[model samples]
Target chain A: MTRVRMDLFVSLDGYTTSDPTPDDPMGPDWGRLTAAYTATRTFRERIFGDTSGAGTTGVDDTYAAAFFEGIGSEIMGAGMFGLHTFPDDPDWKGWWGDRPPFGTPVYVLTRTAPRPSISMDGGTTFHFRNAAIGDVLAEATDAAGGQDVRVGGGIGTALEFLRADLVDDLHLMVAPIVLGRGLRLWDGVPALDRSHTVTTEVAESGTIHVTFTREQHA
Target chain B: MTRVRMDLFVSLDGYTTSDPTPDDPMGPDWGRLTAAYTATRTFRERIFGDTSGAGTTGVDDTYAAAFFEGIGSEIMGAGMFGLHTFPDDPDWKGWWGDRPPFGTPVYVLTRTAPRPSISMDGGTTFHFRNAAIGDVLAEATDAAGGQDVRVGGGIGTALEFLRADLVDDLHLMVAPIVLGRGLRLWDGVPALDRSHTVTTEVAESGTIHVTFTREQHA
Candidate 1:
């Protein structure tokens, strides 16, 4: 089955980010916040294109490797695709320089007008959509070709998918820091325990990897 | 040196408890939320006074037992002492019927009048105080007699101590549930990572025991 999975790097206080700025890119605390995730060998090899093969090979690395495995398509919001920062810039492909990490067909949910799809160097291609979550998920699921569809987040898009009960699996990497104020991931999702079978795995980096899979009913 | 510590049973979304009503004392999901904690032998013997010696002894029980050890005095908000639930009732000792677990001097932070202290059947003694966090902490510290002073919580109280930077050590038991709306524990607490070093341990009960300790500065 083509599952709808989400991977989020969240703070201990439940914030995804502190709001992006032009100077800070993802936000002021972006570097320190994603330290554990970026230190993984999988992140180095897959996301950063660090072909030198230098990175930590721990539990976090294992999860990082699995994050890129079997994911044929991705769905993300405009903010995640850098549209929030470069709304007026037509040439702005994404934050992921020349070689974007996502080698799958990526769908960007935005309110912008329909534009031609941007094909990156890798197998990745950007397709913009301004439709309901169901419609977008359907398109992304079909594009997945029986593989899993990874719902990339900036909190807003993740909340929308989770609120609509559209996510099959959710992997939340809880960083040790507390962001205090920002876009909280669990805003509208009430009583999530009743819906999912929850589990927690602690990494050597002190990140608590909590996974929630929707329960199957009889 | 004896450190002031805290132990909180919190939801995955960082909520301590939902709005408590008479119908739902610890909110609607209280039972499922603290199931593992309350099921421990330490909780059974100390809290429920169950002498039958029937309870699971595991990693969760290890933390549960540690929660009771190395604590001389306790500090909590009026709500945690059940003063909010039974505010008008002059005879309300606490939610713990007869033998309250806290054998140490338990100071309840409230704005009520200066009344005589209530000494329970156990070593627990309830004293009311309307002073500030500094004053109360000082009083509790003195009463601790070189032992640790536990800052017990109901979210609001814990936040007050945390915001004031009075807590030396904090242990948060992350339960696998989300109560979407409630008094959040992390509100107003920004850049907590700058002060504390955090670590996490996962139990068989699926609870993520996260600890934050103030880093010693030379």
Candidate 2:
């Protein structure tokens, strides 16, 4: 069974954007956070489809190499995929242009009906899944080839999984900022009794990295 | 004429929430950020409806107090008003309880037919408006009685006003977080020739305060 994990950066105040969207005002810090993930040669080559300038060396790069090593496939919510309405037209690819960042098979959960899969460079393909969360996770896990399944979030999708206890390991990088208002991460979920045991904590120049594993209920 | 100013705290890259919704792994910093705002008397009283200990003595407190002092009316997007579907139910008040933060009139912009105004405690009333952005701003300004009109956002509504160039002053308190995905502010707006002059920049305990005034175009 592939363990599902989630990795993302958030503000101290639980907001992701200052204007209800994903654009944050903290520039270099945000770049540093992304650099942490993009620094890894394997991760970069796989996601960006560009092997040039591949062997970058940095603290974030080293950590990113380790982070991406275990992931097999990814599942992202419709909102995380794009701001445009789901069942997007054929002309509308995504923010990542013709070559998206994810090289592996990606499943986008939406309310739309079945559509043809989108193929991009670097072996990346996008498949829209309108089924329930459990079915989508199962499909992603099977496609992952015994590797861990990663839940790339848009807050709403992450909550859906959390409510179903589908996520296994969690890694969150806290940025020191606050969005007074926007889409909050935990706005509507019912509280759960599960406890998280901190596995690791690291403070980098851009963000504070913390990893948590859900403890088994007594 | 009343100036419409929007004051908000954003990250360097321009994200408003750590996660798009309120269910991701928001760490301990969330509490700290919430405390930063709740420490302010105006914010506290507006959201929680508790007027106890509402005083501006410290420098941070003074800045927050002055920022929210003279807002006559508020304009919010459909998402910010409530999660309910528009033109479906007129009874859905909002996420906030009976007494919302704003104690004046609130105009909610939508594409559907307008609903009758619903009065609330503390002199707050909710009025649904399906008019054009200019019309809504005009109505809000007229209702403001010479006081500044505060434009509350959800992303869609904020961009509408920014694209229309109806806002006079924009205050963004840059927090130090980045959400790599979600609704982005200024996403689809065309690049304009307008310029903004920084009026003030302050670094508080947790966030940086920056104010920008749009220069009048000839």
Candidate 3:
């Protein structure tokens, strides 16, 4: 069976963004929050498209490699798709440029999803919908084929699926920093531990990796 | 040199107490939050006085042992001293009974502090004072001689020293569970990461131990 998985970057204090605005989306300390993950070799290759083989290896790299592995489809919110940035522009193809990182079917859940699915370079196709999260997940699950369906969060989208108890695997890349300000994750869903078997590990660079896997899926 | 150090129990969401009341002190999920620590051999020997050597050893046990070692004096809030539980009763020597946990001078910082120091059965002496935390720490430092001064927290007390940058070593025993509603520990202390060098480790039982030791002291 195909599993539903997600990976999120947060500080030790469980913050994602700091006083985020539409103009400055991720805020000032976004780099600090994602310092460890971005330092990984896999991140340098996958996200940055660096062919020079730069960035650190080992624990953080292993997790970074797993994030991009076996993911056939992705479901994200308007923010992640960059719909909020250029809502009026018909040519807005997200922040990932023409050659987007995800080489799979990407579903953008928004109230302002234009009409048709836009096919882009690098085997990527953007599907827009305003349907309920469960309905969207069903479509994404089907589109994933035998591979895993990944939830690409702006955090809000992921939490909605998480609160509904749909996510099978969740990994939190916790930076060894205290962001006393910003988005507070895990506010309402207190059964995180009860629903999943959690395993935590510390990387050499002080990044803490915490994974919660649902028993049936495991 | 005498160093100021502290160890606190918090959830992954950085919560200490949840919906706490005078009747139900630590709230409903206190037991669940402390499950791993309580399961440790050192905790069983120290806190429960279970000298039968009946408890799990290793990662959690090592941390539990360290919590009780190399500490000459302790400073805490009135709530931690059980003054809030039995305020009217003059003979109430705290919930720990006569042989309290700390075998050192335990300073109780309270506004309604009674006159004269009360010496207990053990090497423990309850010193009540309405003085500022810095002043109290000075006295505690003096009383500690060359040994470390430990700040025993009700969280609020700990944060006070933390925000003031008085603590040299801060160790957080982060339970794998996330308590959605509780006392938010790192609410205003954003500089916790900036001031100290952080290191995270995971125990076999899934309890995460994160330590923040000041670089100057290190």
Error of 3 at B194 (Å): 1.0
DockQ order of candidates, top first: 1, 3, 2
Model 2 over residues A17-73: C-alpha lDDT tens digits?
Answer: 434343433233445335445555666666665768665556445556666777788
Candidate 3 chain A: 10-residue stretch with minimal lDDT: A184-193
Tens digits of per-residue lDDT, candidate 3, B1-218, equal 88899988898777987887776677888898788889988988887889999998989999888888889999998888777877887777777877988999989998894757889877999899899999999999999988999998688898898878899999888888877788988877746877888889989887889998887853
Candidate 2 lDDT over residue span B1-218, tens digit each = 57788865454345454444432222233443344455677766656656797743454566677677889999998777764333355588876787777888899887766677889977788888988988988899899999888888766677787767677777655443433343445444422223545433333444545455666621
Grade the docking of candidate 2: incorrect
Compose the digit string of candidate 1's lDDT tens values, residues B2-28: 578988888998787788764444677
* Quality class of the docking in candidate 3, CAPRI style: medium
Candidate 2, position B154, lDDT = 65
Would you estimate the TM-scores of all the predictions? 0.93, 0.46, 0.93
Sorting all predicted structures by lDDT, with the top scorer first, yields: 3, 1, 2
lDDT of 3 by residue, A1-218 (tens): 88999998888888877787666677788888888889888999998889798898989999999998999899999888777777788887888888888999999999974658888899889999899998988898899998999998787887888888888999999988887788877767656777888888988888889898998863
> Which candidate, 1 or 3, would have the higher DockQ against the true structure?
1
Q: What is the RMSD of candidate 1?
A: 2.3
Give the interface-residue alpha carbon RMSD of model 2.
Answer: 11.5
Model 2 misplaced regions, further than 4 Å: A1-218, B18-35, B51-59, B83-88, B188-194, B215-218
| Pairs in steric clash, model 3 | none
